[model samples]
Target: SQKIEQNSEALNIQEGKTATLTCNYTNYSPAYLQWYRQDPGRGPVFLLLIRENEKEKRKERLKVTFDTTLKQSLFHITASQPADSATYLCALDPPSGAGSYQLTFGKGTKLSVIP
Candidate 1:
């Protein structure tokens, strides 16, 4: 029985600061990890993807690190802004042969940027 957990709480921070969110898991191994940005009442948009062999992945102001040994991933947003405020989700692709490419996402961490 594998499980994924995120902050589960809103993170409030000042603009231009860096916001870090954590994602932890247990049990099974995943083929890959993905991070997504989701706005209120909308589906998540893909941000970064890291494979089991990879240590880190980056996109623009965002960075994500995957540690298979620890069964965890860390997502970072640098120089944050009000527009950057949103719920971030970390998903893991189930081991191959599951019959789908869909991802299992954590509950997500809500981030709020202050002016």
Candidate 2:
């Protein structure tokens, strides 16, 4: 069966460096991918999405790369800070009819930005 996975462990980083998180999957192909950030006791907030045909996508201080050939995605936060500490999740969209798409998320990677 298709599965999405992330590091089950937490990541520790310094306050001024780039933080890299990884997402990996297997057994099936996805139509697109998405990343979200979730804080304790709060729902996830959407961050970035990329289609299978796209190689890479970016926002102000975040970047995402999707390699369908490898069935993996890499999420990056440049110039990360203590305020940026949170759990990041990666999701894969399985093919579905329009307006009926659903997303399944990986376990999520917890990132801690130390002072």
Candidate 3:
């Protein structure tokens, strides 16, 4: 069975600092890694996606990395702000040929940026 895990504890950071979140998986190899942000009572919104072959990807103040060897992905937010406070989730699709579009998601890591 495939499993995904994220930090169960909340993460607090000062505004203007960088926040790093980790996602780890076991028992499966995915073709893509995705990051999403979810606010209270809202659905997850797609932030970034990185292919297995890609080492890293960046967009605006966000960055993501995929490491197949480690079966892990890291998501980073630069110059954090209070507005960035939310729960961040990592998801991965089943490996190719699995005939499923479903994605396994981590429990998410809550981030709080204090001013």
Clash count, one per candidate:
0, 0, 0
lDDT of 2: 0.89
After superposition, the stretches of candidate 3 with alpha carbons farther than 4 Å from their true spots are none
lDDT of 2 by residue, 1-115 (tens): 4688895669999988999999999977788899999999999999999988999999989999999888899999999999899999998876555454678789899999999
Report the number of the highest-TM-score candidate: 3
Greater-lDDT candidate between 1 and 3: 3
TM-score of each: 0.92, 0.92, 0.96
Per-residue lDDT for 68 in model 2? Answer: 83
The number of the candidate with the highest lDDT is 3
Question: What overall lDDT, based on C-alpha atoms, would model 3 receive against the true structure?
Answer: 0.93
Please give the ranking of all candidate structures by TM-score, highest first, separated by commas.
3, 1, 2
- In the range 80-111, model 1's lDDT, one tens digit per residue, is 99999999999998767878767788999999
* Candidate 3 TM-score, C-alpha based: 0.96
Which 10-residue window in model 2 sums to the lowest lDDT? 93-102
* Residue pairs clashing, model 1: none
Q: Write the per-residue lDDT of candidate 3 for residues 11-63, one digit (tens) a residue.
A: 99999999999999998779898999999999999999999989999999999
C-alpha lDDT of all candidate models, in order: 0.90, 0.89, 0.93
